[model samples]
Target: MDWRTKLLNPKQKARQDYKSLVTPVYRGSTVVFDEQSLIKDDWKQSENGYSYGLYGTPTALELGARICDIEGAKHTFIVPGGQSAIALVYFAFCKSGSHALVPHSAYGPNKAMAEGLLRDLGIEVESYDPLIGKDIKKLIRKNTSLIWCESPGSVTMEIQDVPAIVKAAHEKGVPVALDNTYAAGVLFDAFKYGVDVSIQALTKYIGGHSDILLGSVSVRDDSVYNVIGSIYMQLGLAVSPDDCSLALRGLQTLAIRLEQLEKATFQIALKLSEIDIIENVYHPALTSCPGHEIWKRDFTGSASVFSFTFAKKISGDQVEKFINSLNIFKIGLSWGGVTSLAVVYPDLVRPNKDFEGRLVRLNIGLEATNDLINDLEIAISKIN
Candidate 1:
C-alpha cells in the first residue's frame, strides 16, 4: 500500500530468467504477439497491453507504475524530454481557436512554444503574472481550454497560488497542468493541491544522475489520462526502455539526494541573502523569499534550484565576472544533477519591464556546503 511495499513488490515481479531485479533493458521495435487475436486486442488499448516496443515494454511499464505511485496518479505517460511533455499537454488539450493561459515567468522555452508554435497554430495564449493568485479568474475566457503553471516560476522563483488557480480553472471546466520539474513531486504533490496533470522532466531530479533524457505526465483523472494517452500514441512519443531503467535507478536515491541538496541550498541561499551585493534571495523556504507563506503552506520541502538578484550598483559585466570566478560551480543550463551548476542572469534572462532585479539561477548539487559557500563568497567578492 505504501511506496516501499509497492516498489519492493515490483522488484520481485521483475526477476525471471529473462528479466532481472532491474527489468532488463528491453530494446526492440517489434513485439511478437501470441496470435493475431491477441495483437488486435492489444492494439485496442496500447497502454494496457503491448503491441510493439514503441507502445511500451514490461520494463517501461514497471517504471511507469513506480512513478504513478509516487505521483498518486491513476496513469502516467512518458515522453522524450520535459519540453516534449509540455508540448504533448498542449497538443492533447488545446484545439485550434482555443485559448490557454500560462504564467508570465514560466520557462523561456515553454513561453516560446506558446508564443511561436501554439500561436502559429491559432491557439491564443495569455501570460498572467505568477503572483496573480485568485485574480486569475478574470483572465479565463469562454474559449479557454487549458491553464498551465510552474510553481516558483523558473526565473524569478515566484511560487504561484496553485490551489486558487486549480479551483478557478475547474469552475470553468478547464484542466490545470503543472510543470512540476522544479519541485519534482518530492516537495509537492500536485494531485493533493487539485492539479489535474502533473508534468515532470525525468531528465532532471528523477534522472538524478543526468545520464538519460526522459519526461513524464501523471494524471489523476481517468478522462484526462485517456485524452493525453491518445495524443501520446498519435504523437509517437515514448521513452526508451534503457532510459526508463536509468530513471528508475535514479528515483531510488531521489529522496535522500533531494533532502541533502535542499538543506545545503537553504544554507547557501541564507548566506547569499546576507551578502551586501545581493538584493534578494529567491528561495521559497527562506522567510525573506516573497512567496514564503504560499510555499510553506503548499510545499512538502524545497529543491536545490534557487535564484538571487544583484544590487543595482553591480553592472551586468560585473555579474559575469563573479560567475566566472567560481571554481566549483559550473556554468550550465540544466539542473537536478549531482553536480552544482550556475547560470549568469543576463545570459538567460531578458530584462522585462515588470521585474526589477538582475537574476542569477543556481542549482546546488551534492557538494560540501562549506566548500560551495567559500566558492560563492569568492565569486561574489569579485562582482564589484
Candidate 2:
C-alpha cells in the first residue's frame, strides 16, 4: 500500500470479524463495491443485496426482517416514523382523481394528510363511521383506491370492524391500510385479517421505551411490495441505524413487556369502570367499547392505551384540580413507555369536535398496579 493512502485515519488494515448476539450497526451513505466494474443499482434491494443507506442498511434490514417475522409478512420497509409509514402507503396506492374512505377516528395527523397533500393532489378524502362494517360497501366509489382502518380508533377508543371492512374493500378491488400501532402488531394479525398493507409506529411498543422514534410497513403480497417499494425508493425514506438497533434490543423483551402491559392496562381499565367518576370506559376489552364483540372475535389481546370520560358534571377548574392532585401519572402525550402518562382532550383531536364530556386518555406503564390505581383514585377524588 502507498504511504499516502495508508495515512488516512478512517481506513484500517486490521481485520476482525464482528460476532455478537445483536445486529451490527452499519452507518454509511455510500456502499463500497468489490471492484469498479461490478458496481450496479440493484443494491437497493435490501432483501437481496447491500443497498444505499437511504433505502436500508444491514442494521435496518435486520429490524425489517424482525418485524416481518412477527407480522407474518412477505416484505417489510423501515421508515422514519409511524406517520411517514402512513404517508408512504398513501403515496404508493392513491393517485390523482382517486378517493379513500378513512375512519372518522383515525390518527389526527393521518386525517390531516388526507385533507392536505392528498386533497391538493386531486384525491378525495372521506370519513366513515368507525362502527361501519359490511355497510362500508355502500360508500365504495367507482374511483375508490384505498380504505383505512385503525382498530380502536385513536384517542376515543372505538374499536373498528376490520374483517368486515376488509372483505367489502377487497370485493370492490380496493386495498386496505391499517394503523396497527395500538396492537403493536401483536394483538392483531393484519395479514390474516385480509389487510393488504399494515403500518406500525415502532416508537410506541417495538421501541418499548420513549427513547427512539421508528416505524415499519409490512406487506402481505409481492405485488403490493412492488407498488409501495417503488414509491419508497423514489421518496428517499430512511431511518437511523442507531434507532433501529435500539428497537432490535427492545424486541428481545417485547413478549414479556407486552404481556405485562396488557395485564396492567386491563386491570386499571376494570378498576376505572367501577369508579363513580368515570361514566364510560372505552377499552377494547370492555363491553362499553364500540365493536367490543368484533375486537373479542379478531384481536388476540389489548395494549396499554385507552380512554374515558367523567361521570358527574364538573367545571374546567375541577378538572384542573384533578390533574394537579396526581402524584404519579404525569400529564403527557404519546404512550407505551416505562412511565405512566395522562392526557385530556378538551378540543379533541378532530376539528369537528363531536365527542362530549371530559375525555381523558391514559397510557398504563410498567408500574405497580395498585400504585397506578391509587394515583388515579387520588386525582379523581378532587373532582368527584
Candidate 3:
C-alpha cells in the first residue's frame, strides 16, 4: 500500500479501552458495518442498534437516555434546540387539516410557529387560556389531534393544571404535549401526569451554563415514540455530539444548581412582592401566580424563571430605565444559568388584559440572594 493509503486507514492503533467520568464527544457522519447485508438506516437506534450517525451518535443517545431516566419516559429523542423539539412534535402530531390547541402563554417561538409555518401547512393551532384545565374539552373538535401545555408559561408564569388537561384530551383520543423546559424535566413528572409527549429546551436548565443548544422529546409509551420517531428520521434533526457532551456534564450538577437557584429566586420574588411599585410577582410557588395550587400539586419544586409587573402608574419607559439601572442583573433573555438576567415585555399580549409595557421577566441565577435583592432595590430606586 502507498503512504497515502496507510494515512487514510480507519484502523485504531492505540488502546481503545480508555475510561473517563465524562462522556467523550463522538463526531462522525458515517457508520461502518462489517457486512454489506447489515447496512441500513433506522432511527430506532436504541432497539435496532446504530446504523447511521444521523439518528444520533452514542454521546447524543446517552444524553437522551439520561433525560429519559429522570423524566420517566419510555424513549427520548435529542434535537438541535428547544424550538426544533417543538417543530418535531408539531410535524409529528398535526397534519394538514388537523386542529390543535395551544396555550396563548406558550413559548413565544412556539406560538410563532403555530401561526407561521403550521398555519401555512394548513394546520390550525388555536390559542386557549393557560388556566383552561378540564374545560379544554370544550375546544376539541372532530379534527382535533394535539393539545399543548406549558406550566409556568413563558414570561407570564402561569402554572397549568396539566393532569386535568391530559385527562380531558385523552377522553377525546387527542394527545397532549408539554413544553417542560421550565421544570427541567426532573422538577415536574410529565409522564406521571399523563402527558403524552414532554419536550425541553436543554439550552436552559439541562445545559445549566447557557453555553450549548439542545433539546429533548420524551414520550410516555412506545406508541407515541413511534409517531415522533418517524417524523424525527424524516426531518433529519441532527445535533452536535459536542453539545450533547456538555449537556451530559450539565446533568451532573443539575440538582445542586436547581437547589441554589430555587432558594435565591424564591427569596428575591418574596422581596419583590413587598415593593409597592410591583403589582405582581408571578412565581409558580406564590399565590399571585395563576394556578399556584396546581403547581404545588404537580411539581416537585419551582425553578429560577418568573415574571413581575410594575404598578399601572409606571410607564414602559420607566421599566426600561429600571432594567438599564441594574448593575448585577444583566439585561438579557433565557434563564437557568449562573448569571441573573432581566427583560421587559413592552408589547406583551394576552386575551383581555394589556400590560402597557410594565411587565418584566427575570431569570434568577446562582448569585447571592441578598446581592440580587440589592440589585433590584437599587434599580427600583433609580426608576423612581
- How many residue pairs clash in model 3? 0
Measured against the true structure, the TM-scores of the candidates, in listed sequence, are: 0.92, 0.95, 0.99
User: Which regions of candidate 1 are displaced past 4 Å?
Assistant: 1-19, 41-47, 347-357
Error at 129, model 1, angstroms: 0.6
Tens-place lDDT digits, model 2, residues 272-360: 99987678899999999988998999999999999987765765567667777878898998998888899887777444554443778
Q: Model 1 — which ten-residue stretch has the worst lDDT? A: 39-48
Model 3: pairs clashing at backbone N, Cα or C within 3 Å:
none
Clashes per candidate (backbone, < 3 Å): 0, 1, 0
For model 3, what is the C-alpha lDDT against the true structure? 0.94
Q: Candidate 1, after superposition: displacement of residue 309 in Å?
A: 1.0
lDDT score, candidate 1, position 68: 88
The top-ranked prediction according to TM-score is 3
TM-score of 3: 0.99
- Provide the lowest-lDDT 10-residue window in model 3: 3-12
Candidate 1 per-residue lDDT over residues 24-91, each given as its tens digit: 77787787777777664332243456776666776677777888899898887778889999999999
